[model samples]
Each structure stands twice: as structure tokens, then as C-alpha cells.
Target: MASHSSSKIAIYGAIGANVAIAISKFVAAFFTGSSAMLSEGIHSLVDSGNGLLILFGVHQAEKPADARYPFGRSKELYFWSLIVAILVFSVGGGMSFYEGVEHLKHPAPITDPTWNYVVLGLSLVFEGISFFLAFREFNKSRGDAGFWATLGRSKDPSVFAILMEDLAALLGLVIALGGVYFGHMLDNPYFDGGASICIGLLLVSVAIFLIYKTKGLLVGQGVEEETLDALEALARQQRGVEQVRRPLTMYLGPQDVVLALDVEFHDHLSAIEVEKTVDELQDTIRANHPEFKRIFIEAKGLSGKQRNPLAPDPTSPQI
Candidate 1:
């Protein structure tokens, strides 16, 4: 997971690059009448819009917890990320696929490809810069983890979204360049349309992958199993804790987690002792795992029974 500030830097870089590339690619597409170039233009435009949506999500997710949203609005980032993926699939991929099919039906040879090459070159440069920035930020978060593992475990969507989009943009630019070069060389426009279709498929694949990743976060994914195990172990070390059941945890944001621990204490402990133990355990856990913003302990007697159901301990806080 990346800090919000790091995520913003990557997204802002992508937005700036995509906005410029989209304009130039559209101009080139209009002049050359190349299907692939047009598809690349649409891709850049969609990426630019996605970056803006991600920024909006980050802003909304930053809201403090209130009466209406006790967990804060951190998951708003996930919701907007889902929306961005849908837009990429429906608008970017669908439009490109439709345009490719239409172009294949009536193949139009490029009259002049100089502008196409120029735009593609510049687009590649800009997209590369964006990709580099995003990859760098992501690397900081991933640490020693492998790419696929890090991606699967990552909670922040903004960094990965921009990284994937920029990578796709770079690949799309290559395809468009190949289409323009070969279409002109072989005098076959079908190749250009085929390239557009390839780009469309690429965008769709990326969108689906993103949707799968974001869906888990939107639906309240928990912290890793290892984290839960470590937390349980820490709780078991408390002075009065007899048994620490497995802890339950969920991520509220990239860095926010809510944890619930069920612990069985010895029957001999007094209410005051229980309160002191709970407070000490919470401090220890917080010191170790700062991301666990909310911690609730369910103090249990021997054999998973509450110490007393008739009246709760006044000094012991549940949250």
C-alpha cells in the first residue's frame, strides 16, 4: 500500500502526460485517417479521465469518520476505482472495438503517415515518463515482494491503475506505429484495423483485471492472514490473557484497519485487572501495528464464556 501523497504524485503525473498525448494523438488521427491512431487517441483520453476520477476518490476517501460513516469514507476510493474500470471497459474498449470493426468493413489507406509517426513517438515518450513515475512509486510500496504478489496484496488502487494504464498506452502506441508503418508499406489498411482491435482487447483485459482487484476492496477485504496470526500471538502474550482466539480484521482504507480480538481471561482476575490487561494489550498492538486504527476486544472467561452477561464491566471498553 502507498501513502495517499505518493499515490497522488503518480496520478498527477499520469494525468498531465495523458492530457497532452490525447490531444496530439487525436490531431494525428484526424489527419492520417488511421484506425489504430484513433484508438490510441481514445485510450489516452480515457486514461486522462480515469486519473481525474481517482483523484476525486482520494479526496472523498480522506473525509473523517462521522455518524453516517463510522469507518470513514476510505472505501470511496474503491467505489470510484470500480467506476473507472467500468468506464475503461465500456467507453474506451467498446468504442475502440466498434471503430475497428467499422474500419475493417471499409478499409481506408492512410494518405499521409508523417503526423502519425510524430504523434506516436511523442506519445510513447510521455507515456514512458508516466509509467516510470508510477512504477517507481509502486516499487516503494512493494518492497521485496514479487510484482504479482504485490499487486494482489496492494490496497491502494490509484498507483496500480495509473501504472497499468500507462503500460497499456505504451503498448498501444507500439501497435499503432506498427499498423501505420506496415499499412503504408504493404498498402493494406486491414492491418491498421487489426491493430485497433488488439488495443481494444488489451484495454478490456486490463479493465477486467482492475475490476477483480477493486471489487475485493469495495466489499470490505480483511488484512492478510499472516497479520491476523501475528496480532493473535501478540494478544496472547498479555499478562492476564489465558487464550487469544484468532483476530478478525478488515481494511477501511489503504492504511486504516479495524481489528476485533476475542480473548479468554483467567476466572480469577478481577474487573479492574481485566481492564488493565485490555488497555495494555491495546497499547502493545497499536505500537506494533499502527494501521489497526480501531481495536475492539471481546473479553471472555474460561471456555469462551463471558465473565458476566448480566452486567458488563464498567471500566472495560469494548472499543
Candidate 2:
């Protein structure tokens, strides 16, 4: 619950920063008619939209399990985070490209350079602060991993996604400032259009990268191998667990896992003993692995036959 609250707060901060940056970039673009500034404005506007989606997702994900969703609503975060990534790619990247192409075809004069620089400089500072907050939140879970590796491997996609967005925003600001300075220095609008195109490409790359990473989570990727190995070790150490045949685990949501295991017990163990063993194993798993939430234990005889009458037949086709 505390983690969810923290996530919500971080997303809200990102939303606020993006909204302010959007307004600043819009005003700067209006004053200068700079293609790069305009492209950045669209980027921030899209970021603002993505931030709102993340905020909504975080809230929805906090809902408890119900009849309709026995596994809980945690996956809502992944779904909405994916939607946010797509929006960034389409609205932010696509619009930037379209504007850049139009600018290239029909060059527009950038009348005022001073205001563009001021806005870009201020945006860079604001985005840096926002990005720092995201970084701090991500580090809470990252432990010893490097920043880039943490971004790639962290279970919480929101912080990493926002970090990428902020980095892109910072790069866009640099591109916009460069375009304005070079356009004025070289007396060429083409340079400005080219810079906008570069910014668009950068945003597209970042968006696609984020989508690719988050798609794995949406599709029910397995827990980390290290986590599984740890769970297996814990189960093996239990006195009644003869063997852990197959341990299957999947991420139910960020930092939440559902674990299913097939275990063989001694042939002479009574039904009561088996139940006690299973309960002990479940408790051990939960105690050792903070991420594992729901555990399902399938007890098997020495001959590898399931003890439960309702267990699915091995040869039966699954739906």
C-alpha cells in the first residue's frame, strides 16, 4: 500500500512538470514560430497525457481482488502503461515528424531567438528535476543495478517509462536550442527543420524501446530466474518436500507474482501430513520471497500422480 502511494505521488509530480513544460514550450513556439520549439511543445503535451494515464493506472491497480478479478487489478497498471507508451509514440513522435516534414517543405522564419533559448533552458532544468525524482523512486527497487540496467529490469514500469520520457524531453530541448542558434547563425530555416526531425526520431526510438520492454510484462513474463531459484532453494530445504518437480511463476503485476508448483512427497505421508507440508511450504515461500503473493501447491505421489481428483489429465487438451 505504501509503495502504491509512492508511485501515485511520483506520477502526479511528473504530470505537473509536463503540464508546465508544455505551456512554456507553447508560448515560446508562438513567439518565435520555431519548428523545434513547436515539436517540443507537442512532445510535452503528449508526456502530460501519458503521465495522467499512469496516474490513473496506479490508482486502478491498487484495487483489491474481487469476484470479477480473483487475481486482483494489478495488471491494470501494465495495460495502461502500454497505452501511455503508444500515445507517446503516436502523438509525440508522429506529430513531431509531421511538423518537421511540413517545416522542411515550407520553411518558416524564426523571428525571436532569445525567448526560445530562455524557454528551452528553463525546460531542461524542470525536466532534470522531474527526472531526478523518478530516478530516486526507481532506485528504491533497483538495489545494485546500474541506472540503465535498472531502467530495463525494474518491475515498476511507470518510473522507468517516465525517466525515458524526461530524458527524451531533455534531448529535445537541446535539439531545439541548437536549431534556434544555428538557424540564426547560418540564416537558414532548413537547419531548424532538420533539428526537429532529429528530435522526432529520438522520441520515436525511446517510445518503441519502452513499448518493447513493457510488452513482456503485459504478456505474463516469468519472474526473474534468480527469484525462482531462491524459491526453489527454500522449498527444497523444507523437510516434507521430497522434490520440487516443476516450479512455474509469473508476474501478476509489478512486484507481485503468482507461484504454481508441483511437489512430490514421501509415499507413506498421510493426507493430513501432506496438507501440513503444503501449508508450511507456502508460508516459507511467502516469508522468503516478498514478491510472491498467491501460491498454489499440487501434491504428487511418489509415482508422480496428482493427489487431487480434479487435477487435469496429462494427455487432455487444454483450452
Candidate 3:
């Protein structure tokens, strides 16, 4: 709950910063007729939209588990973040590329200089502030992990998504300012067009990367290797469990996992004792791995055969 609240606040800050940057870029584009500035404006607009989507996702993901959805609504975070990435690629990158191509075909002269640079400078400052907040939150969650590791392993997708977007925004701002500055230096509108194309390409690349990671989560990817190892170790240490036959674990959402384990237990335990041991093992495993919200355990003897007389066939051939 606290994490979700903090993410909402961070996203709100990002939205405010992007709004200011969008306005500044729009004004600069109008004053100088710079394609790069215009492209950046569109990028900021997309970022603002994505921030709102993330905020909504944060709210929805906090809902408690219900009958129809017993796993709660955490996966909504990934679903919404994926949509944001697709929008950035389509609306932000695609439009920027189209505008750049148009400018290349029909170049326009940029008249003003001072106001354009002023707006670009202000945009950099605003985006920098937003990036700082996102970085602070991400670092708090990351602890000793490197930045790339945090990006890959963080349970809160919103913070990581915001971090990537903010980084891309900062780079886009630099590219836009450079395009204008260099275009003026060389007296060539082509420089502005080229810079716009580069910015679009960068945004597209980032969006694609985000989509790839989010898609994996949405498709029920397995838990991290470290998490799986932890679960395995806990299972092996439990009494009456001789060995772990197979352990299957998958992430239902951020910080949530569903685990299925096949274990070999001592053959001497009676039915009631076996049930009690299994229950105790479940409690122990859950206490050890808090991330596993759903657990299924199958217990068998050392020979890989069930000890209970009424146990289902282990290898029943289907017709």
C-alpha cells in the first residue's frame, strides 16, 4: 500500500513536469518552426498520457482479491504499462518520424533563437527534477543491486517504467536542443530533421525494450532464479520431505508467485500424519517465501509412488 501510494505521487510529479515541458516545446516549435522541437512536444505529450495510465494502474492494482480474481489485481500494472509503451512507439515515435520526414522533404527556415534556447533549457531542468524523484524511489527499492539489475528485478513496474521514460525524455531534450543549436550554426534545416528522426528512433527503441519485458510478465514467466532457489532450499529442509521431484513456480504479478512442488515423503507416515506434515510444510514454505501466494504440494514415497491407497494414478495413459 505504501509503495503504491509513493508511485502515485511520483507519477503525478512526472505528469506535471511533462506538461510544462510539452508547453515549452510547443512554444519553441511555433516560434522557430523546428521539427525537432515539435517532435519533442509530441513525445512529452505521450509521456504525460503514460503517467496517467500508470497512476490508474496503481489504483486498480491495489484492489483486494475477489472471487472471480483470487490473485488480486496486481497484473493490471504490467498490462497498463505495456499499453503505455505501445502508445509511445505508435503515437510518439511514429508521429515524430512522420514530421521529420515531412520537414526533410520541405525544409522551413527557423527565425528566432533566444526564446527557443530558453524553452529548451527550462525543459531540461524540469525533466531533470522529475528524473530525480523517480531515481530516488527506484534506488530505495533496489538497495545494493546495480541499476540494470533493479530495472530487471524490481517488483514495482511503475517506478522502473517511469525511470526509463524519464531517461528517454532527458535524452530527447538534449537531442532537440542540439538539433536546434547545430541547425542554427550550420544554417541548415536538415540538421533539425535529422535530430528529430534520431529522437524518434531512440524512443522507439526504449518502448520496444519495455514492451519485451512487460510481455514476458504478462505471459506468466517463471520466477527469478534466486527466488526459485530459495523456495527449493526451504522445501528440502522440511521434515518428512526426502527430495524435491519437481518445483514449478511462476509470477502471477509483481511480487506474487504461484508454486507447485512434487516431493518425496517418508512412507511410514499415516494419512493423518501425512496431512499434518504437509500442512506444516506449507506453513513453513509460506513463511520462508512471502512472495508465494498460492501453493500446491504433491507428496509421494521414495519410490515416486503415492503412499495413500486412494491416491490418483501417477502415470495414467489417456485415450
Error of model 2, residue 241, in angstroms: 2.3
* 123-171 per-residue lDDT for model 3 (tens digits): 8899999999899888887888888987888756689889899999999
Residue 19 deviation, candidate 3, in Å? Answer: 1.4
Predictions in order: lDDT = 0.87, 0.82, 0.82
* Candidate 1 C-alpha lDDT tens digits along 82-194: 99999899989999998899999999999899999999998888899899999998898798899989988888888888888888889888988998999999999999999
Stretches off by above 4 angstroms in model 1 are: 308-319
How do all models score by TM-score?
A: 0.93, 0.93, 0.90
Best first by lDDT, ranked: 1, 3, 2
Clashes of each: 0, 0, 0
Q: Best candidate per lDDT, number?
A: 1
Error of 3 at 255 (Å): 1.9
Candidate 1 worst ten-residue window by lDDT: 310-319
**Pairs of residues clashing in candidate 3:** none
Candidate achieving higher TM-score, 1 or 3: 1
Candidate 3, superposed: residue stretches over 4 Å from native: 271-273, 303-319
lDDT of 2 by residue, 1-319 (tens): 7787776666777788889989988998998889988999999999999998888888788787877887788889888889988888888888898899999999987877988888888888888888888877888988888888777777786778887888888888888888899998888999899888988899889989888978998888887778778878887886666788557888877867878888887888877788777777777777678677767778877878777422222322222
